[model samples]
Target: MNNKQQIEKMTDMMSKFIALVSYKLPDDVENKLKELSDEETNPLAKTIYNTMEENQNLAQELKRPSCQDTGVLQFFIKCGQNFPLIGQLEKILRDSVYQSTLDTPLRHNSVETFDEYNTGKNIGKGTPSIFWEIEEESDKVEIYTYMAGGGCSLPGAATVLMPGEGYETVVKFVLDRMTSYGINACPPLLVGVGVGTSVETAALNSKLALMRSVESKSENENAAKMEKLLEDGINAIGLGPQGLKGAKSVMGVNVVNTARHPSTIGVAVNTGCWSHRRGKITFDSDLNYEINTHKGVKL
Candidate 1:
């Protein structure tokens, strides 16, 4: 195909992908939900899990969005210098989201900031936020697509700490937020925690943490340990499915960290609801693609 044809093809693929994730949970998320369901002993929580499963089944059978709030689209991209459509990716993703909004009949979620009006097409100025990382010596691009719903990612929290506060303060910040607003996210949630030198960096890293697989751990040993500690602590809260209280409160806790200034600590927390509409797709130089999040699925 010519360059124009390639671009069109990519856009179509992405729109289909958006539609796919709108209704179907990622494989890891599905399995984790099932695992949580099987382990639960509370009658109410078990019934809630069953209802969630049934909702997915009905959504797939009807080919409709599983949630009423389809969410604002977000893309985290890692593109290689040799990727053929490096320059056109931003436009392509925007176009794809617009197309998906129409084709999937996604809820109109993009309202221009301070302009006070819904764009109706889900594509406004920076509506579908895109974050990028450029790879040096490869010919493939990997993209993580996420639906940041109003109750989850949109309500994420961040804070800066004094030098004496330490990491314990970070834990307190996260737990406090969870206790206050975790139910608003429709738990059990997949929690993403980020620690960096600034609020913006921490917030961005927190979103990146949500893009990871449900079971992924940070490469840093301390961060991994924090993940486990936080997971245990959150589960101890018994937020359960739909925040009704049960055996578990979260799918997992993922921590992502960066070296921070010696005098300061910055922390943020973001979350994904049980449906966790996060997907990873990779395209090579020739545009051959692989779906990493949902197995045995095609777009």
Candidate 2:
């Protein structure tokens, strides 16, 4: 196919994939929720889990969005330097967002800053925010599509801590935020904690952390240990499912970190609510695709 045809095909596939993501939770998330539900002992918490499961089922059966607030769309792309569509990748993603807005009927969540006007199309100055990572000597592009609802997105925070404060302070910062505002994001949340050299980097890493599988542990030994401690500490808070009090406060705590400057310890927190709507799609040089986050499904 010509470039125009290739772009059109990819766009169409992405539009449908976005719509699918809206209605279906990724396999890791769905499985985690199920495990949590089975482990929960409280009657009310169990009921809430049941309702959540029902919601998922109904959304898929009816081909409708699981949550009313689809939030803002964000794409985290790891593009191969040699990927054929590298030049057109940005335009393709933008077009996919526009097409998905209409086809998936995503909630109009993009609003112009200062102007206070809705974009209606979910495309504005920076709507459908895209983050890219270019891979060397590769021929496959991996794209992560995430829908960050307002409730969950609202709890995101980043800060630079004094060097002396140490990693203990990082734990304290995350705990403080989770206890104070995590309830607003809906319970059984998947928490993403990022540690880097600065606020911006930390913030971005925090969001990236959210995209990791709930079952995956950080490669860094210290970071992995921190993930366990934070997960236990957060669950100890008793936020439970829907924050109504249950056996666990969160689905998981994921930490993504990078070496930081000696002068500062930057940390950030991002949460994904019960219905964490995100998916991963990878395309080869030939444009063949594989959906990693969701299985037994085709776009």
Candidate 3:
């Protein structure tokens, strides 16, 4: 296809992809939730799980969004340096989101800051937030799109710890945030923790960590251990689904850590509610696409 034709195709594909993700959970997340439901002994927790399952089913069968808050659009992209559409990728995404708002009737979440008016297009200054990672020696672009609702994004916090506070302090910070705000997020939550040299980097990493599957583990051993410990600690809080009080509180916790300056330890925490509406898509240099978000389905 010519460049213009390719762009149009991509835009159309992304609109459909956004609609699909609004209603469905990723395959891995769906399975994990089912597993957790089977393992839970609390009656209320079990009921919540059953209800969630039914909600998903109704959404799929009836072709409706699972949650009323379809959420603000966010995309994490790993683009190949050699990709033909690299230069236009950002514009393509913004346009796709704008088109999707009309096509899927996605909630109008983006608004101008001082103007205080809905963009209606879901595409405005910094709307449909997109983060990019350029990779060498790759011919395809991989994108993870997420809907970060107000509730789930509430617990997101970032602060720089004094050097003396140490890495353990990071754990404590996350645990504290989870205990205090995890309930509001509709557990079991997927917790994302980022550790770096500065608050901004940590905060960004925390948001990026949300893109990882709940079943995935950190690469560093210490980080991995901390992930397990935090998961245990958060689950013990008994926030349950919709914070009603129950057994486990989080689906899983994934920590992404980077080298830090000697003076400070930066820590940030971001969470995803049980619905966790996110999707993954891969496109070749030619812009041919495959979406791997949901299971047993083709588009």
As a whole number from 0 to 100, the lDDT of residue 54 in candidate 1 is: 99
Query: Rank by TM-score, descending?
Result: 2, 1, 3
Off by over 4 Å in 2: none
What digit string (tens of lDDT, one per residue) describes model 2 on residues 228-297?
Answer: 9999999999998889999998888999998899999999999999999999999998788999999989
> Residue by residue across 32-118, what tens digits does model 3's lDDT show?
899989988889889999999999999888767889888899999999898888898898898888887887778888889999998
lDDT of 1 by residue, 146-240 (tens): 99999886448998999699888999999999988998998989999989999999999899899888889889998999999999999999999
**Model 1 spans with C-alpha error above 4 angstroms:** none
What is model 1's C-alpha RMSD? Answer: 1.0
- C-alpha positional error of residue 23 in candidate 1 after TM-score superposition, expressed in Å: 1.1
lDDT of 2 at 80: 91
Q: Rate the local accuracy (lDDT) of all candidates.
A: 0.92, 0.93, 0.89
TM-score of each: 0.98, 0.99, 0.97
Clashing pairs in 1: none
